[model samples]
Target: MFVEVGPDDFSQQALYDRLCETDRASQSGAVVTFTGRVRDYNAQGHIEGIELEYYPGMTEAALQQLLKQAQQRFALTNAGIVHRVGRLANHAQIVWVGTCAAHRNDAFNAASYLMDMLKQSVPIWKKEWANGEAEWVAAKTTDSQAAMRWLQETDEPGA
Candidate 1:
């Protein structure tokens, strides 16, 4: 498992390739990946960009724990997540999650679980830039609902 939180942008293809190179890749039959990008607009208006902030060490530790949980819950062979911080323009990649497992279902479920949990539990904050002003983005109820769905489901592979 790998977890990274940083200001540097990442190449999704490179990360996917690395996931395929994991020690147990030959034993895994499926690999799932998710990429989140900054949208050009939000409910407020047209967006210029977004700035994400997080407490460095604390944020990474939280992400690492999340990865470990995902590994255990899904019986994943490999998993990795990368989240970008600082100012990012519209359409720039914001986050990437990859998971590999012996079954396609496990990989797909693990990827979704990681992204949903990250949005709801991580300590990252985002400030949206729009109409010549910036505002701190608030957590959406939809995000909380998404995360709750996983908790409510008892069909997890390793549960």
Candidate 2:
């Protein structure tokens, strides 16, 4: 499994190809991919763009820990995560997660777990540039709730 955090132009096709190659190499029967994009509007209202910031080594270490947790909890053959930083325009891809497993259930669950953990546990922060002003965006309650669900599950079926 690999987790990468850096500046990327965000290409879906390129990511898809890489996932396919990894899946093939790992001899997995299923692969699940997810992409998160910057929305044009936030909960407050309209947004022009967003700037993401992270504390370099800490952010990568946090993601690696999440990946380790996923590996322990799921029957995955391989997994990969890539997150972009710096200023990003509206509707640009911000994150991508790929999971490969011997079955669909594992792949699906791992992908969900990765996203949930990333949103909840990662230290990365976002600043919204909207209406000619910029402000730090608070973490969403819904995301925290989603992440909590995993902790509540005593034994994830596919884990």
Candidate 3:
């Protein structure tokens, strides 16, 4: 498992290749990855960019805990997550989450879990630019609703 929070931009392909190399490619049968990007606009109208803020050690610790939970729940063979900080322009990649497991279901589910947990637990805050004004982005109830779905799944069989 690996967790990183920094200002550098990273590519999904590079991460996957590294994973495959670190863990023999023959062992894991599935690999799942998710990438999130900064959009050009938000409800505030045209967005020039977004600035993400986080507490140094706290942010990395939270992400590491999330990865550990995912590994325990899904029995993932390998997992990695990288989140960008500082200012990012519209269309710039913001985050990447990846997982590899012996089965496809585990890989997919673990990746999804990491992303959701990042949304819920990470201390990072995003400020978007609108009409040359900066506005802090608010958390949406819909995200909590989505999180509830995962909670429900954990109660079901084979979760």
The clash count for each model shown is 0, 1, 0
lDDT-based ranking? 1, 2, 3
Best by lDDT: 1
- How well does model 2 score by local distance difference test? 0.87
lDDT of candidate 3 over 1-159, digit per residue (tens): 788899999988899887777767559999899999999988646889999999999999999998888888888888898999999999999999988888898899888888877887889999998777788989878777776777777442125
| Model 1, residue pairs in steric clash | none
Query: What is the clash count of model 2?
Result: 1
The list of candidate 3 runs beyond 4 A from truth reads 155-159
After superposition of all CA atoms, the RMSD between model 2 and the true structure is 1.5
For 53-111, candidate 2 gives per-residue lDDT tens digits of 99899998998888888877887877888999999999998999988888898889999
- For model 2, give the 10-residue run with minimal summed lDDT: 7-16
List the lowest-lDDT window of 10 residues for candidate 3: 150-159
C-alpha RMSD of each candidate structure in angstroms? 1.4, 1.5, 1.7
Query: Deviation in angstroms for 65 in model 2?
Result: 1.4
